[model samples]
Target chain A: MGRTLAEKVWDAHVVRQGEGEPDLLYIDLHLLHEVTSPQAFDGLRLSGRPVRRTDLTLATEDHNVPTTPGPITDPISLTQVHTLRRNCEEFGIRLYPMGDAEQGIVHVVGPQLGLTQPGMTVVCGDSHTSTHGAFGALAFGIGTSEVEHVLATQTLPLKPFRTMAITVDGELADGVSSKDIVLAVIAKIGTGGGQGYVLEFRGSAIRALSMEGRMTVCNMSIEAGARAGMIAPDETTFAYLEGRDHAPRGEDWDAAVASWRELHTDEDAEFDAEVVIDASELTPFVTWGTNPGQGAPLSHSVPDPATMDDTERQSAERALEYMGLVAGTPLRRIAIDTVFVGSCTNGRIEDLRAAAAVVKGRRVADGVRMLVVPGSARVRLQAEAEGLDTVFTEAGAEWRLPGCSMCLAMNPDKLAPGERSASTSNRNFEGRQGKGGRTHLVSPLVAAATAVRGTLSSPSDLEPLEPLVPAADLAHQEA
Target chain B: MDAFTTHTGTGVPLRRSNVDTDQIIPAEYLKRVTKSGFEDGLFAAWRKDETFILNDPTYAAGSILVAGPDFGTGSSREHAVWALMNYGFRVVVSSRFADIFRGNSGKAGLLTAQCSQDDVELLWKLLENEPGTSVTVDLVSRTITAGDVVAAFDVDEYTRWRLLEGLDDISLTLRHEPDITAYEQLRPAWKPVTG
Candidate 1:
C-alpha cells in the first residue's frame, strides 16, 4: 500500500529521526493566543533561551479579548492581552493585537493572511489549531510547555499518529452545511471516537466544499478527539491561496502549486480505520446534550436514554439533566435564550453570509438575544461592506467586532446562569458558554433560525426570507 | 521543571472519568498571567462541593492524584498541570491520560503513571479505607506502592528518561538546529515563509 497524505506530510517534516525515541518534528508555523502563551513565554524567560525562530511565530489576542471593539475594560483580560504584546516584544515575536487590521482569532488570521499552506507542520496552543489542516498541513494543538519548546526551537518531538479515512460521499442537501456534516459524524463516532487518530476527510462531498467550509470541518477535529483533520490540496486550495498577502507570488506561486499538487493520497493508500457517510442522508444536525457527540437531527426528538449503549446511557442521562431536558422531548421545542454565530468554527465571512441569508428581512423573536460576532476584524469589515451587518442588525441581532466571543466564554460575551443558547461554535461542554449555561451546537443557518423563533429551529421551521438582492443591487448598496 | 526520581505522598482519590482541563482549571481562571499560583484554581468548581476528594480533609495534604481514566481529557492548557503541581501533586496515577495532558505533565516534571483500571480501583479503595496513608511513586523503578499493594506502571520510556533527568526540551531540540537549517535551505523558495 502507498502512504496516506498524513504520513507523507509527517515524513517530509521530520528533522531528526530519534531511533529509540520520538522523532523530532520541524514546525513551520507557530500560532499563539493570549490564554495559553503567557505562561509559555515565562517558561522561556526562566530558561534563559532566546526565541530560536521568531520568524515562524505569530501571536494574536483572541481568547479573553472582548468582542465590543473598544479599549479592553476588564482588568484581568486587559492584563492578559497586554502581557502577550509585552512578551511578543521582549521575545521578538510578531503580534496582531486587538484593533489591528490583521488581528483576529489565531486560526482565522493565519489562513486569511495566506500564512497557512500545504505540507507544513503548524502548532498552536489552542485546540482549533487543527483548522490549518484544511490547507493540507499537518496541524494540531499543543500544550504550554510545547509552546515554549516550539518558541526555543522550531521543532517538536512527536510519535506517529494512526490515520482514519472519513469518506463523505454524495451531495449535501440544500441548506445543510459543513457544520451539520461534522455534527452528524460526531453523533456517529461519539466524543472520543477518533482518539489516537488523524482523520483524513476524503470523497466527493469534502472535495466539493469551499475553503471556508473545509476549514469548518477541520476546525472541529478535536471535538471528535482526533489530533488533526486534513483534506488534500486541489484547485480549490490553490485558488484560495493565490494572490493573498503572504501567499506565494509570480514564479514562486507556480512552483508552490507544483509542490502542493502532489499532496493527495495515493489510490492504493491504506487507512488504518475507515468510516463512510453519505452527505445527502444527513439532516440539519444539532447537539442536545453537553458534548458535541450527543447530537441528533433537528427534525428528531431528543434521544431516549434507553436508546443509547450502556456506557453512553449514563452520560446521556447526565447530559439531559444538565441541559434541563427530558427524554422524548421534541428538539424543536427546546427554546433558546440566546444565539451566538461566531468562533473559529463558524465565524468566517462565509459563515456570516450564511447566517445573514437566513436572518435577512426578519425579526428576532421577543425575549431572545442574538449576537453575530465576526471571526476577525477583516471579516467584520467584509461583512459590513457586503451589508451582512445591516441584515443582521435589522433582524435584532448585535453585530459585534471580531473575537472568540461566547464560544469558549473566555470573554464577557457569555450566557447567564441557566440561560440556554443555540450556538454555532464547536464544543457544547457544560459551562462552555457560561456557568450553568446550556449550549446547543448547530450550523449558522440553524443558529439564525433559532434566533428568529427563540427555539432550537432550523430554516425549514420559519418562513424563508427573500433571496438576496441581485448582484447589481448589492453592489449599488455597497456604493 | 523538577526531576521526578521518587515521590511519597498521600493519594487523593478522584473517582471521575473524563475530567477535562476545563474542570481542572476553568477558562475563567486562565486569565491569570502567572503560572505558579494556580493551586487556587485547580478544580475550583468541583472543590466547592464538600464531597470532592480535594475538599476532603483526609486528602488535604495529598500530593498524588489517583483518578479514573481519561484524566485531563480536554484542552491544551498546561495550567491544569501547574494547578495540580502547585496544589502539591507530584504524580498523577490514572489508567490513562489524554495525549496532550500526558505530554504537558512530562515537560512540567509532574509524573503521570499509567495503571490498569483494576489496579487503579484497588488503589482508590486503599486510599479511601486508610486515610492519610501515603503512596510511593518511583519513576526509576516504574512502580507505584501503597501499604501492601504494589503495581507496575508505565510511561513512554523517552518521556520517563526526560522526567528523570529534568531535561529542558527546548535545549534538547536545539541540538538539531543544524538539521533544521539544512531543511530550510532546501525548502522551495516558492513556499511562503511563515514570517
Candidate 2:
C-alpha cells in the first residue's frame, strides 16, 4: 500500500513512537502571537526550562496591536504585547514588534518571509495557523499548554489524525473564487463534518488556484472542523517559494524542490473518508447564520427553518433571530452596515487587487462604511505600490495598516452592537467580530461590491454608474 | 493537573449546537495574560439574557455541561477550557466535540465524555425534566449515569490513562530528549530557521 501525503509527513516527523503511546512529532516551526503565548512563556519560566529551539520559534504582536497607529491604548492589550516582547527577548526568540515591517498576523508573516515551506510541521497558538498548510506542511493549532510543551521540548506527542480527501473538480465560473468554493464545501459538509481528519484538497480546481487563493482555502480548514488542510506541492508552489527571503538558495533550492516533488500522495493511497464537490456548480456563496455551514448562494433566498430537521430547525431559528433576518428574503437584498476586506484568510495583495478592481471608479454606498486592512505590512506596501490604496480610499473606504483587525476584534477595530457586515475573513460564529455583531462571510469581490450597494452582492450585480458628462461639454456640443 | 477517575455534579443542559469558543469566552476576555479568572466571560453574551440557563437558580451550581452535538467547534482558544473550569465545570457530555477542544479539555483535566446521539438526547431530556438531577461521569467504567438512565461513553485510551494518572505531558516528552536530538541532526539543511 502506498502512503498518503499526510501519512508520509507524519511518519517523517516522528521522533518517537511506542506501544500505547502517542507519537512524538518534531516541530519545524512555531509561530506565536501576544494573545496565547504569555501563559506558555510563564509556564516555561516556572518550570525553570529554557526554550529548546529558539531558531525554529518566532513571535509577533498582532492580535492586540492597534491597526490605526499610535501606541497600544488599551492597558490590558498593551501589557499582553509588552509581555510577549519581554518574553521573546528573555528567551532569545525572534520578536516582531508592532511597528516592525515584518510584524503582522503570524500566519501571513510566516509565508511572506518564506519561513513556511513544504514537508514541514508548523504549530501556532492561533486556529488560523492552518493557513501555512498551503505549502504541503502538516500545520495545526495548539492550545497554551501544548504551546508550552513545544517551547520546552520542541516536540508534541500527538495521536495520528485520520485522513480525508476533499476533491473539488471542474473550473469555477468567472465571478466565483476560492472563497466561494470553500464556503460551498462547508455548507455541504457542515462545520463538524471534517472532525478528526486532515483534509487534502485535491483535483482540478484546487490545482488551478494561485498561491494566495490556495492559502485562503486552506486557512479555513479549521472552520470545517479539520485539524489541518493541505495541498500537495507542485510547480506553482515551487514558483512562489523560488526567491523568497528564507527559501533555500543556489544548489540547496534544487535539492529542496526534488524532495518537495515527492510530497504528493501516491497513486494507490487511500483516505479514511472522501468528499467530492463540483466547482462548476458553485456560485457566489455567503453565510446566512451564525456558523460557517449556514450558507446559501447569493442568488438564493434565506432558507425557512420549517423546511429543516428538528435540530437544524432549532439552530436555524436561533441563527435567524440573532442575524435579524427573515426567511424568503433574497440574499442579494440583505442590507449590511459595514464591509471588512482583510484577514489572514483574504488579506494578501491579490485579495486587495480584486477589491480594488471593483471599486476603482465607484463610491461606497451612502450608509455603508468600508475598511480595507492588509494582512501584513509587506502586503500593505505591495498594495500601495500598485495604487490599490488610492483606488480604495478614493472610493470612500478606509485603507488601514496590517493586523488581524475586525476579524477577531481583539484590538480597537470592532463592530458596534447590532451592526452587520459583509466580511472577507473566515468564521461567521456568533460574536466573532464583536458582541452582537452579525457577519456574512464572502469573497473579496463580494465584499467590495456589497460596499458599493449597501447590500450583499457580487461584482456581476453592480451596474456601471452613468458616465459623467460635463455641462460645459454638453453646451459646446449643442452649439 | 488533577487525576479524574470520576465526577458527580448537577447538569446544565446547553441546548445549542456549534457552541464555538467565541461564545464560550469572547475575544475581549482573551486580552488577559493569566489563564484563570475567566468565569465571568463564559457565555458572556448569552448570560446577558436574564432567562439564560446559567442564570436560572436550578443549574447555578452545576459542574457538568450536557450540551448539544458539535460542542466547542471553532477557534483554538484554550480560554474556553479555562472559562468552563473557572465557572466550575468538570465534565462536558456531548455526541461530538471538535478535535482541538477535546485535546484542550484533556490537558486541562476536564473530562469530555462522548456518547451516542440518542444517549445524549436522553441525558438532555433527563437533566431538563429534572432540573437539578445529579449526573455521575465514571471514567473507570466509561459510563454516564443519571436517574434510571445509564449509558456508555468513549474516550481515547492514552488520554484516559493520562487523566487517571494525572501525568504531565512536558515531563513525559522530556524523557525522550535523546531521540529528538538525533532526529534534529538528520534534518535537511534547506529547512528555514527563524533567526
Candidate 3:
C-alpha cells in the first residue's frame, strides 16, 4: 500500500528502526516556551550535555508573560520567564523575549518566522505544537524529558502512530470558519476518538482554507486526543511561506516549493481509520459544555440529556451542570461575561481582520468585557499599521499585546471564579482558563458578535459592519 | 529515571474519564524552575474537597492509580508524570490513555498500562471494595492482579524494555547520531532551517 502523508514524513525522519524497538527519529526543530523548558534545561545541565543543535532550537517567553506592556507582575510567572532567558543564554539557543517583535505564542511565532516548514519533524513542550503540522510537518508535543532529550540529542525515540483521514467536502457556509469545522469534527468523533492516531485532514474543505485557517484546524488536534494533525502542503502553503523572514529566497524558494509539492498522500495511500464531515452542513459552531467536543451549531439548542444515549446522557448532564446551562437551553441565548478574541488558535492577522470586519460599527455590550490580543508583537504592530487596534478599541475591546494571555491563564489575564467567556482559545477543560471560570470556544467572528450582544451571537445577530469608509468621510456622514 | 521492575502496592481507583493533565498538575504549579517536588501540587485543585481519592487516609499510601478511560487527556506537561511519580505512583492503569501522557509516563519511568474497559472496571471495583487493596503489577509477565481480580495488561515492548533497563532516551538516540547526520546531509539545500 502507498504510504500516507504522515507515514511518508515519519519514514523520512527515522534514523533507525528495529523490529521490536521504537523508531529513533531525528528532530528538525525544537520550539520552547517558559513553563515547560526550565526543567528540561536543568536536566541538560545536570547531565553536562550541551544542546546538540542550538541553531535548530528556539525559545520564546510565552505562557506566563503578561500581555500588558509592562514587566511580569506575578512572582511565579516572573521567575519562570527569567529562568527561560537564563537557560536560553546559557545554552546559546535563540530566544524571542517578551516585547520582541518575534515574541508571541510559540505556535504562532514558528510559522510566521518560517521556522516551521513542510516535511520537517517539529517538537515542542506545549500541546499545541500540532499547529505547525499545517505546513505538512510531522510535529507533535513532547514532555519536558523529551524536550531535554531533543535538546541534548536532536532525535526522539518514537512509537509509530496510526494514520487517520478526516475528510470534509463542500464549501463552508457564510460566517462558519476553520474553528467551526474543527469543533464539528471533534463533536462527531468524541475526545478519545483519535487516540494513537495522526490525523491527516484531507478533501476539498481542507484544501480550500487559507494557511492561517489550516493552522487553526490543526492547532486543536490534541483536543480530539490526537497527538498531531496535518494538512498536506500545497500552493497556498507555498505562497504563505514564499517571503517569510526565515523562508528560502529566490531560486531556493522555487526548489523548496518543488520539494513541498511532493508531500501529499499518494493516490493509493491507506489510512487506518476515516471520518467524513459535510462542510455545507456546518454552521456557526459553539461549545455549550465544558469540553471542546461538547459543541453543536449555534442554531441547535443545548442537547437534551434525555434524548442522548446512556453514556452520553450522563456526560451531558455533568457538562451542563459545570457550564451553568439547562439541558434544553438555546445555545444562542447563553450570555457571556467576557469575549476574548485571541490565542494561538485564532490570534493570527487573518483572524484579527475577521473580527475587525464584524465589529467596525458596533460597541461591546453594556456589561461585557472584550479583550483583543494579538498573537505576537509582530502581529500587534501589523494590526496597528492596519488600524485594527483603533477599530477594536472603538468597539470597546481592550487591545493588548500577545503572549498566550488567558488561554491557559498562567499569566495575569485570567477569568475570575464563576465568570463565563466566549473565547477563541483552544481547550475548555475544567479550570483551564481559571479556577472556576467557564469558556465557550468560538471563531473570531463569533467572538466579535458575542462581544456586541453579550450573548453567544453570530454575525446575523448584529448590525452589519459597514463597508470601508475613510476616517474623513465617517465624520462628514455623522453630520 | 529509576528502573521500574515489579511493583506491588495498594491501588486507588479514580473513576473519572478525561482526567486531563491540567487537573493532574495545574498550569499555576507549572511555573517551578525544576521538575522535582511536584508532589505537593499533584491534583492541587481537586485536593480542596479533602475527599478526593488521593487524599483519603485509606488510600494515602496507594502507589497505583486505577482510572477510567481517556486518562491524562490534555497537555503535554511531563510535569504531570513527575507529579504522579513524586506522589509515589508506580503505575497508572486506565482503559485508555492519551498518547502524549502515556509517552511522558514511559519517558519518566512511570508505567502506563492499558487493559480492556471490563478489566479496568473490575480493577476499580476491587480497589474501591477493598480500600488499600494491594494489586501486584508484574511487568515481566505484563499482568495486574489483586484478590479475586486479575487481568492481563499491555505495554509496548520498547517502553517495557526501557522501563526495565532504566534506559535514557537521549543516550539511546545518540548512539545513532551518524545516521541522523547522514540524513541531514541528504536534505534539499532549499529546505528552510531554524537559527
Candidate 4:
C-alpha cells in the first residue's frame, strides 16, 4: 500500500521504532515563546542538560509582549519575557527580542524566516503551532514537559496519529474565503470529531487558496480538536519559500523542491477517516456560541436549541446564555463592540491587504473600535510599505505593531466584560479573549466590513461607496 | 512525575460540555513562570458564581472531576493541568477528551480516564445526587468504581505503563542517543537551521 503524506513525514523523522513501543521522532525545528518555555528551560537547568540542537531551536517574545511601542508595563509579562531572553542567552539558542525586527508570534516568525519547510517536523508550545503544517510538515503542539524533552533530546516518543482526509472541492464564491470554509467544516464536524487524528486538507478548493489562506486554515485545526493539520506541498508552497531568509539556496533549492514534491499522499493511499466539503455551498460563516463548532452562516438566523438533540440542545442553551443571544434573531442584526484583525491565523500581509481593501473608503461605525495588529514585525513593515497602514488608520482603525494582541489577550489588548467582537483570530471558546468577552470568528474581509457596520456582517453586506469626482471633473460637468 | 496506580476521592460533577483550557485556567493566570501555585486560578471565572459545584462545601475537597464530554478542548497550555493538580484534582473522568489535553495530563501525572457516555451519565447522577460521593479510579484494573456502580474505562497500553511505572520520557529517549545522531547525519543538507 502507498503511504499518506503524514505517514511519509512521520516515517522519515523516526529515530527509533520498536514493536509495542511508541516511535521516537526527531524534530527538525522547535519554536518557543515566553508563556510555555520558562518551565521547560527550568527543567533543563535542574537536570543539568544543555540544549541538544541550538541551531534547530528558535525562541521569540510574543505572547507577553505589548504590541504598542514602549516598554512592557505589566510586571508579570515583563518577567516572562525577560526570563525567555535570559534562558535563550544561557542556552545558546537564537532569540528575537521584543524590539527586534524579527520579533513576532512564533508561528508567524517560523514561516516568514523560511525555517518551517516542507517534510520537516515542527514543534511548539502554543496550540497554533499547527500553523506551520501548511508546508506539508508534521507539526503539533507539545506541553512544557514534552518541550523539555525535545530541548534535551531533540526527539519525542509519540504514538502514531490516525490520518484523516478533509477534502474540500469546488471553487469558493465571490466573498467566501478559507476562514469561512474552515468554519463551515468545524460546524459540520462537532468539536471532538478530529481528536487523535492529523487532518490532511486536500482537493481543489484547498489548492486554490494562497499560502496565507492555507496558514489561516491550518491554524484553527486545533479548534476542531485536531492536534495538527497539513496540506501537501506544491508550486504555491515552493514559490513562497524561494528567497526567504533561511530558504535553501543555489543548487540546494532544486534538491529541496524535488524532495518536497514527493511529500504528498500516493494515489492508492488510504485514510482512517474522510470528510468531503463543497466549497461552493459555503457562505460567510461565523460562530454564534462559545465553541467554534457552534456556528452558522452569516445569512442565517441564530439556531433554536430545541431543534437539536438532548446533549447538543443543552450545550447550545448554555452557549446562548453566555453569548447573550436570542434565538430567531438574524445574525446580521447582532451588534459588536470591537473588531480585531490580527493573530497567527490572519495577521499576514495578505490578510492586511484584504482588510485594507474593504476599509479604503468606509469609516468605522460610530462606537465600534477596530485594531489591525500585524502578525510579525516583517508583516507590519510590509503592510506599511504598501500603504495598508494608512488605509486602516485613515479610516479610524488602530494600526499597531506585531505580536499576538487580542487573540489570547495575554497583553494589554483585551475586551471588557460583556464586550463583543468580530475577530479574525481563531477560537471562540468562553473567555478566550478576556473574561466575559464574546467573540465571533471571522475572516479579515468580514472583520473589516463588520467594523464599518458595527454588526456581524460580510463584505457583501457593505454597500459600494459613492465615488468622489475631482474638482476639474465637476467643473467640466457644470460647463 | 509521580506514579499514579490508583486514587480515591470525592467527585465534582462539572455538567458543562466543551470545558476548554481557557475555562480551566484563564489566560491571565498563565503569566506566571512557575508551574505551581495555580490553585487560585483554577476555574477562576466560573468560581465567581456562588452556585458553582466547586463552591459547594460538600465537593470542596473533591480530588476527582467528572466532567461532560470534550473536556480540555482548546489551547496547549499545560497550565490547565498544573492548575487542576494544584486545586487538588488527581483524576478527570470524561466520556471524551481532547488529544493534547489527555497527553499533557499523562505526563503531569493527572489521570484522564475515558469511560462510555452512559457510564459518565451514571457517574454524574450518582455524584450530583449525593455530593461528596466517593469515587475510585484504578489504573491497574482500568476501572472506575462509585458506590457499587463500577465501570470499566479505556486507556492505551503504553501510556498506562508509563504512568504505572512513573517513567521519564526524556531519559527514555536519551537512551537512543546513538540512533538520533545517526539519523541527524543522514538528514538532507538543504534543511533549514535557525542559526
Each candidate's DockQ score against the native complex? Answer: 0.62, 0.88, 0.77, 0.87
Residue pair clashes in candidate 4: none
Docking category of candidate 3:
medium
Q: Write the per-residue lDDT of candidate 1 for residues A216-331, one digit (tens) a residue.
A: 99998888878899999999998999989999888888888888888989999899999999998988999998778889999999889898765567778878988999988899
Candidate 3 segments exceeding 4 Å error: A309-311, A465-479
lDDT of 4 by residue, A1-479 (tens): 99999999999999999888999999999999999999999999999999999999999988877778899999999999999989999999999998899999899999999999999999999888999999999999989998999999999989999999999999999889999988988898889998999999999999999999999889989888997999999999999999999999999999999899999999999999999999989999999999999999999999999999988999999899999999999999999999999999999999999999999988999999999999999999999899999999999999998999999878999999899999999988888898899999999989999999999988888899898989999999999
Model 1 ranges with Cα > 4 A deviation? A306-310, A465-479, B129-133
Instruction: List per-model TM-scores for chain B.
Output: 0.97, 0.98, 0.97, 0.98
| Residue-wise C-alpha lDDT for candidate 3, range A283-352, written one tens digit per residue | 9999987678889999889888889876567777877888888877789999999888999899999999
Candidate 1 positional error at A384, Å: 0.7
What is the overall TM-score of model 3 with all chains considered together?
0.97
- The top-ranked prediction according to DockQ is 2
Best by lDDT: 2
Please give, as one word, the docking class of candidate 4.
Answer: high
- lDDT score, candidate 4, position A99: 81
Of models 1 and 4, which has the larger lDDT? 4
Which residue pairs collide in model 2, if any?
Answer: none
C-alpha lDDT of candidate 1 relative to the true structure? 0.88
Ranking by lDDT: 2, 4, 3, 1
Worst 10 residues of 1 chain A by lDDT: A307-316
Residue lDDT tens for model 1, B1-195:
577799999999887666778888888888888878899989886777788787778899999999876677668889999999999999998987877788888888889999998899899899889988889999899999999999999999898888888888887877778988887777666655556
**Which run of 10 residues does model 4 chain B get worst, by summed lDDT?**
B167-176
